[model samples]
Target chain A: MKEIVVISGKGGTGKTSLVASFAALAEKKVLADCDVDAADLHLVLNPKINYREDFSGGKKAKIITEECIECGECEEVCRFDSMYYPDPENEIPCVNPIFCEGCGVCVRVCPVEAISFDDAVNGEWYVSSTSHGPMVHARLGMAEGNSGKLVTIVRNKAREIAEKENLDYIIVDGSPGIGCPVIASIAGADLVIVVTEPTLSGQHDLLRAAELTAHFRIPTVICINKWDLNPDIAEQIETAAKERGIKDVGRIRYDTAITKAQIMKTSVVEYTGGAVSEDIKQVWRNTIYALG
Target chain B: MKIAIASGKGGTGKTTIATNLTATLASMGKTVQLLDCDVEEPNCHIFLNPHIESSTAVTTPLPDVDEEKCTGCGICAEVCEYGAIAVVKEKVLIFPELCHGCGACEMFCPEDAITEIGREVGIVEEGRADGFRFIHGRLKIGELMSPSVIHAVKIAGRESEVVIIDSPPGTSCPVIEAVKDTDFVVLVTEPTPFGLNDLQLAVGMVRALGMPFAVAINRSDVGDNDVKEYCQREKIDVILEIPDDRKIAEAYSRGEMIISAMPAYQKLLETCWGRIIDIHRNWGELTS
Candidate 1:
């Protein structure tokens, strides 16, 4: 089966909106929302969760205050600088969960063995039922690290469901940026579609995103969402993509109906077969053909 | 005070709000620093067009195993959390990209065969944008060490009276790294369903960090009123609301600051700043 991952380097460029439309248009497909930190495709797909499990992306260090040496050894060994003395009176360094990278060096250096490397419930993954088919999604907890690992878990589950059902595709909605989570979503995908806009920030970010895909030797294309907002910049972006040997698969016009459809809790294609829907359908057709 | 303008959703005008606010405050003769911490994309430079004075390489430590000193006992592999090291057939192989520079392998090696080496993942550039100090980071393509670069950018910037940080989108480590330690955070979001959803997550994130935060709604007229209603119901302060104007979009599309493109936006931004100061002072009183 082929996998198509939709990404946008700059956020709010309509990646989820397009993915929701793809979910409505595509056949024999299992969806994956790999934007675990701030997932929005589920809001559009309205998935009913079938199964879920706590996801432990990595380990975190916890210090036992009672059996403390407070030699400051753990603080010195922690490369992440996660250890801090919240109360100077107590003198024991507390591990700041947000700053912890789960490297476990602090645990190893604690002379008194007061540090315990414990599993952290960083997030949760779900196997859900949607109107299109089965879906895999996740929710990375607030202030949690290891989002890339959670993304990989979601994709693997989607792949498993697709293989078991003999599905044709796994369409994934990826997060913005060329960071760890975005890399995890598109690293092994069959095709990568970068949904961008006509703004200067969008254009700048698209180049980096494209460079990342090219570095990974992944087949990639571009979709300029809200292309009409700046037709001149949109044209310039398309020209730049061509110079980079990246295909411009589609240009979605700025439409109020798309947001209205989002509020209505359905895909644009399912909401209306109007002008914006037509534009998305064209993008869908080109994406499928490009995948082949 | 250090204030971070961030959004859970990308292109929700984090850069726009940050650039405009910094520029406006600077032009009004306030000492401000703009720290663009979105290393992966780093688009604040596009709008600000800062004159970069110098760029410092942002490097992370990677374990370099000395084959000669090694017995190939596989102890380093056991201690590494990232699985970056492997003893294949008693031959050590090191993957520098996977190493998080935590020094676990080198620290735990019985023979002390492993040594730490520098790996350049990005660069932090310090400059001057208009009347304010500017610093931004550019992450190497395909590199996953954005947090390190963001940290370097935050460090590289010269501290000023009002520090405005433009953070990356999302609620993960990179975002956390960019937003941490700031006095206050301005959660920038649009007024759509996706915006509201991501805003809720962002709220959870800032609340978890115990940060004093306020919301700024961009393109407030476009999608729905759920965002404003939610903020009001939650008793969260709505600091600023920018209407969906064609000129604002046009100005942003051309990489022009909103205050420069439309002078009236200057007042809006100034009012936003006033609100931030007031709210932050109140927060300080309560916390202290």
Candidate 2:
């Protein structure tokens, strides 16, 4: 099975939109939205969740105030400044959950053993059936850390489903920025399609993203969205990609129907039979050929 | 006052508003500092075209095990929360990428065999854009630690009278690191469904941090008005609205700041700054 991951180093580069359109075009494919921190593919695909699982990405230390001795050792050792004194005159401290990085040093150093480490529910993952195929996605809790772990879980679940159903491809919608979650999404993929625009920021981020894929030794293909917005920058991007030995797979013109289709809760290919739709179709064809 | 410009979704014009606002503030003779905390892709430098004054490498501490003094009693491994260390058959293994530099393992090591060594993850560049201060970070490709780099950038801009942080697109840890201690957060979003979806997530993040925030709708005329209605219902002040114009896009594609390229957006951004100050002042009154 060939796995194709769609990524854009910068956010809001239409990664999910392109993935939704690819889901409509590809056959016998399982979809995974690995952008768990802010998953948006479901906004268009409208997946009906059939399986749900609670994810405990990491542990958070909780201090039992009742068992506390008034010594301030825990606060002294904490690098995160998570220990909070409820009363200014008192020594008893409470752990602020947001600031705590779950390092567990407080639990180890507490004289009275007042701190207890417990599992925190960081997020949830779901396996659902969509109009395209089996879709696996997740939602990271607000302000929660360890999103890279959640992305890994979603991708593994999608790979399992693909194997069970004998699917031909697994198309993943990756998160923005080449951070931990992006690394987790791109590693071990058969091919990575980077969707970028024609702005200077777009060009800069695309280069950084290409560097990441090259470090992982993953073959990458480039697609320029809204190429008509700045054809000069688009040409520069193409030349840069070629210099890096990356191929340009497609270029979609600036189209208003892309957003309109998203508002109507459908892919661009399904909502319109216009020039943008034709561009997406050609991109899909190029992707399949490249994968082969 | 430190203001953070963020959007839960990418490419929604966070940089556009941030760079333009910084330029406007500098033009008004304010000591403005713009820190692009999107280390993964720091784009403010491209728009500002700042002259680099200095560059410093940001490093994180990774544990190095001393084989000579060590008994592999597994005490260090037990104390590590991230499982960054392990004792396998009288040998210690360290995973530098997984280490969070919490100093737990090094401090609690029974044999006193663990020491911290610096691992460079990114670099922070400080410079001047006209009269305003400009700073940004570029994370070494494939580095997982961005919050550390962002923290360093924030520390560099702490002394400025007005600091504007341009945050990465996401409501996760990196976004949190960028906007946590700011006076006010300005969320930039378009009016589409996807934009609204991510904007709501960003709003939840800011509210969870107990930070006062407002919204700025870019490409205001392209998508529907659902975003505006949602903000109204939530009682969030719509601070700025920049309509969809081909001229703006052309200027942006050419790497020009909207304030200088069009010269009309200066008044709009100044008005937005006025709303931010008003909201921040009221929020301070309620809290203090």
Candidate with maximal lDDT:
2
- For candidate 1, write residues A1-292 as lDDT tens digits: 9999999888888999999999999999999999999999999888999999999989898989998887999888887878889896877989998888898888777878998888999889999998789999999999898888999999999999999999999999999999889989998899999999998888999999999999999999999998999999999999999999999888899988888999998998899878888999999999999988
Q: Which ten residues in a row have the lowest lDDT in candidate 1 chain A?
A: A103-112
B247-278: candidate 2 lDDT, tens digit per residue: 99989888898988789899999899999988
Q: lDDT per residue, candidate 2, A1-292, as tens digits? A: 9999999997788898899999999999999999988889999999999999999888898888889998888999998888888888778899888778899899988988899999999789999999898999999988888899999999999999999999999999999899899999999999999999998888999999999999999999999999999999999999999999999899999999999999999999999999999999999999999997
Q: Highest DockQ, which number?
A: 1
Model 1: per-residue lDDT, tens digit, B1-288?
899988888878899899999999998999999999999998989998899999888999988888899998999999889988999988888887688888888889999888888899999899888898999999999898789899999888675788999999998889899999999999999998889999999999999999999999999998888999999888789999999999989999999988888999999889999999899889867556
TM-score for all models, in order of appearance? 0.98, 0.98
Q: Report the Cα lDDT for residue B156, model 2.
A: 84
The clash number for model 1 is: 1
What local lDDT score does residue B8 receive in model 1, on the 0 to 100 scale? 87
Clashing pairs in 1: A11-B10
lDDT score for candidate 2 against the true structure:
0.92
